[model samples]
Target chain A: MLKKHNILVVEDELELAKSTLAYLTENGFSPFHAKDLKSARKLLKQENFSAVLLDLGLPDGDGMALIKEIKNAKNEIGLIIVSAKDALDKKIEGLELGADDYLTKPYFFPELNARLKSVIRRLNLEVNQEIILNEITLLPEQMRTLIHGEELELTAKEFGLLLYFVSNQNRVISKTTLGEFMSSNYADYGFTDDMVYTHIKNLKKKLSGSGCDDYIKNVYGVGYKFTVA
Target chain B: MKLLTKTSLNFISASVLFFLVGSMAMYFSVRNIMAEDLRNRLLQQQNEFIYTAQQNKVMDLVSELVFVQTTQNKQLYSFSDTVLITNEKYMLYRKLDFSYAQNEQDYKVSILLSQSESDKLIMKIAIMNIGFAMLFFLIMFFVNRHSIKSALGVFYSTIRKLEDFEVTQSSTLSLDTAEIEEVKKLNQVFEKMSAQIRKDFISQKEYTENVSHELQTPLAIISSKADELMQADNLSKEQMEQLALLLETTNRLSKINQALIFLTKIDNRFYTEGSTFSLNDLIKEKLSLFKDAIQDKNIKLKLDLLDITHVYMNPYLAETLIINLIKNAIFHNKSGGVLRITLSNNTLSIANSGGSLSFSEKDIFKRFTRSSENKKSLGIGLSIVQRICDLYSFNIAYSYADEHQFKINFKK
Candidate 1:
């Protein structure tokens, strides 16, 4: 069994903090919530967390301060900023201050989950060297993907989507979430739903063409889910 | 009418009227005085004749030029003026009729003297006054016109300066002095009002931006909490439906927030101008990106492309504009509908074979005009397209003739 990573969520709003904690728990992670920057730092000192979801605005201080604090720690903790839409500059600033990734407010839980996994992987990857999802296998450190002993001709966008979906198994993902993930990699204008659908189509076609059974299931009005069942 | 032209016209007419009325009054008074003097001189000639012929009996020196004898009893004298022919020229004659006892004899005397010279002098005065009046009119007209033109020059210079003032380039409007007082007042008022408008605009933009930023925290909470509630098991169908609706609403609210932020950024000049980009390439790329969606709807696209369609604009905005236009076209289209795109020099047009538009074409570019059955659209896409086109001074027009068409004429 995979060891569940612990995450610390720093948010001022009680409802948002509760929702985030609930989501983390549902996804099988041990989660802690702090309503302000002071408690967040205190929690960091008392126990170890795999990642810190930092909201930029807090009651006593800006969540932005936590990025620098986390960076200076002896064992570095992954920092993921959760900011409002207009805080584009602060997002960049936080990243420069040794934060690993950031998510805009109103972000989906699946999207957050995907980002958390990504950030934690970069900070400290899992001990298991290989990931197996039925016929497909992904070696994160090698950046190589294979299916049924055949090499995949995957574009950079396709490979990134495959990796995120594989890592976040059984999670429903919206078009906005996928587009944002792709744009983060390319640093281009965030894509539209149509583009996301196109990439997903290409990804599904390539995977299925390689003698793999159907894995990506559309959730009708909700979004698409990547699950074997 | 221009102020100068109007005032100059009024001035010319007023001066001309004054000169005419003045000259006419002078002419009548001078003529009346001249006629009275002629009558007085004629009466004096009659008295001198009586003194010479009757009192001194100096009949040898009496001249017969203006004298006539008449036999009439108790005659009284009367004087009148008449015109006479003298050397084929019209002359004035003042005639006097009298019966007087001269040398103790009853004689009726009729005397005449020429008043033609005084009449000619009056005529000359009338001619001089008319000529002088015309000269005065001409001089005053030119003076009035020159002063008006110079005053108008000041007005136009101030107006031209005002016209040249762009809000982005200049913080304050400066005006040259105006000789016209009313124009000066106009300038002062405009300067004050424009400055206030600029100030108010900045404040309003700042407030909107701040509100938009502040809404994000609460909105995120609402959305995430709603999503969490949706994942709970054993929920009724009604609960699930309500949650789904709530999520959709939250997503729309978020889109509106983003749209407003985009507006504030554009207004704040966050995107700097100038970059050469291939518009053709962007359009083609966006079309390809939408291929899957279009295929899902079974839509066919007809393309007419030029060899090159390069344009000068911010590349990011250009891409966004194209994407919005294509997205709007695909989203509103009918299944198996035909989408036609034409790209040429400085022009690009998109036509989609959708049924009649739900709203008027004029309202299509306005914010929040949802003209289709698609619930996923926020109705802000076309307005954003219009705004981006407006920022670049590109003329975009929408029309529906068997198919809905949006055409943009780029400024080269």
Candidate 2:
């Protein structure tokens, strides 16, 4: 079994923290909630968390200031900023400041969860560079992906996308986030979700044709998820 | 007419009227003065000559007599009158006749006094008067024009500043170059107005950000709680239905808020970064993303991608426009329908097989206005697409000819 990740949520609102904790706990991860930066700092000292869900607005101070301290204290922690709507500049700034990913506020917890996994996966701080799920095996260094012991022919982009999904499996990844990962430049093109969908389709078609069972799941009006269903 | 032209024309007309009145006064007064002086000098000379003639009646017999004429009895007084002295010159002179008793005999003496010198002097005065009036007119005209130009410069500078005003630039108007008091006052008013607009604009942007930030907490809580409720086991049928309705309502509210915020950001000119990329690749990628939906619906996709089209735009907005268009087509289409996308040159056209829309093409781009076929739509997708097209000045045309068609023509 894969190790269940520990998630720390730093939010000023009690209800939001509760929901975040509840969602994370339901997903089989240990969750710690902090209502302010002070508590978050204290929590960071007392325990280790796999990821931190940061909110920019806090009761005591700006949440952006805590990111530097969090990074300084723990380099392995995956930072995901959940901020207010239309604060795209701040989100980019957060990403530049070494936050793994960001989402605007009023976001679904599932989105937060997916992004947390994606960020952690992309960070690749672990020793296991090889990921195998079911009959699919992904060699990250070689940029090669195989299904059912047969080499699957994938374009460079398709290969990268497959590896991304293999690394962050069982999470509902939105087309927007997926597009950002695949092209590394289409995040600004809000319409690229269709492109992400197309790539996922091609990847799935190639995988299933090679005697691999269907593993990619679609969530209508949402996004796609890779799981051994 | 321009301010400068209008004022300059007025000055020209006023100067013309002034020259007309001034020339008449100057000509008459100068002529009168010159004529009076010449007449007085002629009359004094006549008196002196008469005195000399009276002193010696034989002066007429002497060679010094100006004119010596004897007439019987024609009583005509000496008077000065204007006469044509030459072809080009006129002269004023007095012709005199007096009785001179030469050796006690009755005789009529006539004396003619020529005033050619005075006539020349009067002609010079007239020329001087006309020359002075013309010189004054030209000087005043040029001075007035220069002053008007400077005054108009103030307004021109104001116009230039107004042209430079841009909300996205976030710079205030500086019309301190205006000089005229009234014009300066107008510039000051505009400066204050623009400053207020900039302030209001910034505050409005910040307010949206703050308000949306505050809204997210509650929205997150409600959605999360709804998701939790959805997973609850052993729920009654009615309760489950009610929970689903609640979740739907919450989701709808979130979508509306999100769309509103996005529209506000676009209007505020927030997305500034852009780059060039292969639009063909982006479109192909998006089509793949929608493959499953296409398969489930069994819709046939006809692609006529002729060339590798390049688009320079904010990638985020570009992607959004593509997805929204494709999604809208997919959402509104019937099962086993056709979706045709033709890309030729800078034109991209998307058409899908669907029932006739109840809404007119004009009203389709409006937010929250959905077709009768799709109740689940947020209806802001087309609005966002419209806005994106509008921002880039790309033409978007829609039609319903067998299939709902949307065509976008991008600049080459």
Each model's backbone clash number:
0, 18
Tens-digit lDDT string for candidate 2 (B1-412): 9776787788778878877898788778867786677567656756776677767664454342245656555454565353546557665455555555556564565455556675677678778877887888789878887887777787887888788788777556778656688887888889889989999999999888877777766877886676566455465656655665665567567768878888888888888789999889989988887765677678999999998889899988998889889888887878899989999989999999988878777898998888776666788999999999998899999988799999999883
TM-score of 1: 0.69
Residue A221, model 2, lDDT: 39
Task: Compute the lDDT of residue B411 as modeled in candidate 1.
Answer: 64
Computed on C-alphas against the true complex, the DockQ of each candidate is 0.30, 0.28
Deviation in Å, model 1, residue A27 alpha carbon:
7.5
True contacts kept of each: 0.40, 0.36
Model 1: how many Å of interface RMSD? 4.1
- Model 1 docking tier (incorrect/acceptable/medium/high): acceptable
- Give model 2's TM-score versus the native structure: 0.72
lDDT string for model 1 (A1-229, tens) is: 7888889999888888888898899888899999988898899999888999988878897777778878788345788888875545677798898889888877777778877886777778563467788789887666677899788788777888888888667765655556656655654342456677888899999988888778887655445667766
Q: Return the top candidate by DockQ.
A: 1
Cα error of candidate 1 at position A59, Å: 6.6
Worst 10-residue lDDT window, candidate 2 chain B: B58-67
Candidate number achieving the greatest TM-score relative to the actual structure: 2
At residue B330, candidate 2 shows an lDDT of 80
